[model samples]
Target: MKRSRFTEEQIIGILREQEAGVATSEVCRRHGVSSATFYKWKAKFGGMDVSEARRLKALEDENAKLKRMLADAMLDNVALKDLLGKKVVTPAARREAAAHLRSAYEMSERRACRVLGVDRASVRYQAARPGDGVLRDRLKALVQERRRFGYRRLHVLLRREGHAVNRKRVQRLYREEKLSVRRRGGRKRAMGTRRPLETPLGANQRWSLDFVSDQLTDGRRFRTREALSLVVDTSISGQRLARELDKLIARRSRSAVIVSDNGTEMTSRAILERTNRTGVAWHYVAPGRPQQNGFVESFNGRLRDECLNEEVFASTAGARTVIERSRTDYNHVRPSAHGGLTPEAVRLNLAASRLRNVTSCAGRPLPSAQQIGHQTLGLS
Candidate 1:
C-alpha cells in the first residue's frame, strides 16, 4: 500500500480543525488535498490519537515481514521437493538445477536461482575463451623433441617461436598434458663448508674447461671438452687439447683467466706454453676438487643428463656431429638463467652495451659510423 504524505499527528490536527467547525472545502484547500483523500483519512484515523496511529503502522510492518518469510519458506519447500536426491555441488550443477526449475515448473529466474543457491550472474555466464588446438599441438611437439625440458624452458621455446603466450598459461597446459619431467635421485656427498662462486660480469671475462665422457654403441669411450662459455671441442689427447685451446683463444678472444680441474691434459707443458703465449692465466683447482670449477662441472652434469644419457652414438664422427648440434642449441636456442635469453643473445647484448659506453663518453664526441662498425665487428 502507498504511504500517506501527511503524518498521523498532522491528520489528527486537521480532523480537530474540521471538528472545530472549519469548512471542509477550506480545510482541503488549505492542505492542498482532494476532498476524497480527506474523507479516506477521516475514515481510517477519525477517532485515533497519534500514539494509536504509530502502533498501527508498526503492526502493519511486522505483518508484511511475516508474509515475506512465509512466502520464502514455501518456495524453499517446493524447491526441495523438486530437487530431491539430486546433488548440486558445483556452480555449473547449481545453474543446471535452477534452469531445470525455471523451465519445468514455470518459475521466474530470480526465484529459481534463490532456491537453488546460485548467483544470477553465474547462471548467465558463458565461456568466451579462444581454442588452444594449435598451441597444444606445438607444445606436445616441443615436449617430444626435448623430453627433459621443464615447462619454464618450454615457455621460453614457445616465446622464441613467436607464440606471445604467458608462462603461467604454458605451465597450466604442461600440467594438463602430463608432460612433467621425472627427477632422478642424486648421490650423497660429504658435507663441507659451502662458498658461493663469483659470477663473471661479461662474456669471455672468465672461462671454465671440463671433459665429459660417453660410450659408443660398441662400448668404445669418447670425451668432449666443453668450455663453459659456450664452446665445445672433441679431443682425445693432451696435444689436441693445446691446439683446441689456441683455436678457442683465436676465435673467442683472450680471456682474463681460465679455470679448470687438475687433470693431466690441463696441467700439461703444451697447455702451459699455449696459455703463456696468449698471456692468459690458467688457474687449476685442487686435485679431486671439481667443485672449485663449479661452472664447467654444472655444464657437464647437464650435458650428461640431457644429451649423453639420451643418445647412443655408433661412431666418433656421428658423436661429434650430434655434440656440435647440441652445442649450437645450447648457445643460440636454449634459454639460460640470464633473464630467459640464450647465451649468445646475452653475449651480444653485453658487447653492444660495452661498445655504447666506450663510444658515448660524457665529454667526447660521438664516433663515426665507420668506427662504430669496426667496434661492432671487433666485439663480435
Candidate 2:
C-alpha cells in the first residue's frame, strides 16, 4: 500500500506527543495513520526542531512542485504518443527511426524517373556524365596514397588538385569506388583520445615495421619484405641508422622496448611471448592507421620507389643481396630529413664520440655509400 507525504505541522505535533511520553500506537491511532507511518515521520522530524522544520517547509513545497512537473512532462509524452498513433507498449516501437540515402546519379527526369519513381522535372541529378578520366585517376591515386577519402573531403582535395569535380559527381564516385567513410547510427559520446603520432626523434625510440610484395624474373611471386625499424632521436635531428639491421637488432635479450604495427609477422604470438620473457617491451599500433606507425610506412614508400620498384630480382638471394646493399646506401648516403646523417656515418661518429656504444655491425666493411655519392678515386 502506498503512503502519503506528511506535512511539517503534522510532523511537529506527532514528535511533540511522542516526546511527552504518549504511546506511539495511541498517537498513530488518534492521527488515523499506521504505526509504520508515524515512525517514518518520527525519523524525518526526529533531529529537526520546529524552527528548522519551518525553514525547510518551502524546500519541501518546491520538491512537491518539481515532482508534479515531472509527472506532467511524462503525461505530455504519453499524450504525444496517443496524438502520434503510437499506443504500442513496446519502448522499441516508440523509438524514433531515421534512414539516410543519397542519390547522386547524373540523370534527367527521363532517367531518374526510371531509376526512382519521382518525376524528372522534380529531380536534381546532373544531366551529363562528368567524364574526366584524368581527374578520376588522380583522385584514385590520392586515395590509394593517402588511404582515406570521403565525398566532401575528396571534393576539396580534387578542387585543390585542379579537378573541377562537383559534390554530386564526387559523391557518385565515392559510392562507386566504396571510398566513403562508413557511418553508423547511434548517440555520439565524447571521449578524450590521442591523435596519430608522426615521425619520432631519438635513436632507439620508434621503429616502423611493415611488409611488401615483389616478384622474381622466373615468374616467382614473393613478398619483398622490410623491417624499417629506425629509432631516431628527433632531438638529435632524427638521424637514420643504416647498417645491417640483422646485425644491429637480431640478437637475443637485454634491450629497451621495440614497437611494431601488426603485419602478420609482427603480430606473431612467439614474438610477443619472447619479448615479454626477454623484458623488451613490444607495442603494436592499431590496424588501418599506418600514420600511427608513420616511420615504417614512409620507409615502405622509399623502398618501393628506390629499390624494389626499380629492379627485378633474379632470385631471393640476389634480391636479398641487392636489398642489403640498397639499405647500406640508404643508411650511409641518403640524408634523412629526420636523421641528418647516413646510418653508417652516424654509427661511426657515435662509436668515436661516445664510449660503451655497441651494435653487432661487423664485417669486411665495404666502401661507404657517402664515399660512393661523392667520389674522387672513390674518396674525398
Identify the leading candidate in terms of lDDT: 1
Q: Model-by-model lDDT, in order?
A: 0.72, 0.51
Which residue pairs clash within candidate 1?
A: none
lDDT of each residue in 44-157, candidate 1, tens digit only: 888899999889878989999999999878867887798888888877778889888888777899988878777899999886888888999999999999988899999999
**Model 2: residues with Cα > 4 Å off, grouped in runs:** 1-202, 225-255, 338-340, 347-380
Backbone clashes for every candidate come to: 0, 14
TM-score for each of the candidates? 0.60, 0.35
| TM-score (C-alpha) between model 2 and the true structure | 0.35
Per-candidate alpha-carbon RMSD to the true structure = 12.1, 24.2
lDDT at residue 249 of model 2 (Cα atoms): 56
* lDDT value, residue 194 of candidate 1: 50
Off by over 4 Å in 1: 1-126, 186-190, 225-235, 359-380
Worst 10 contiguous positions by lDDT, candidate 2: 371-380
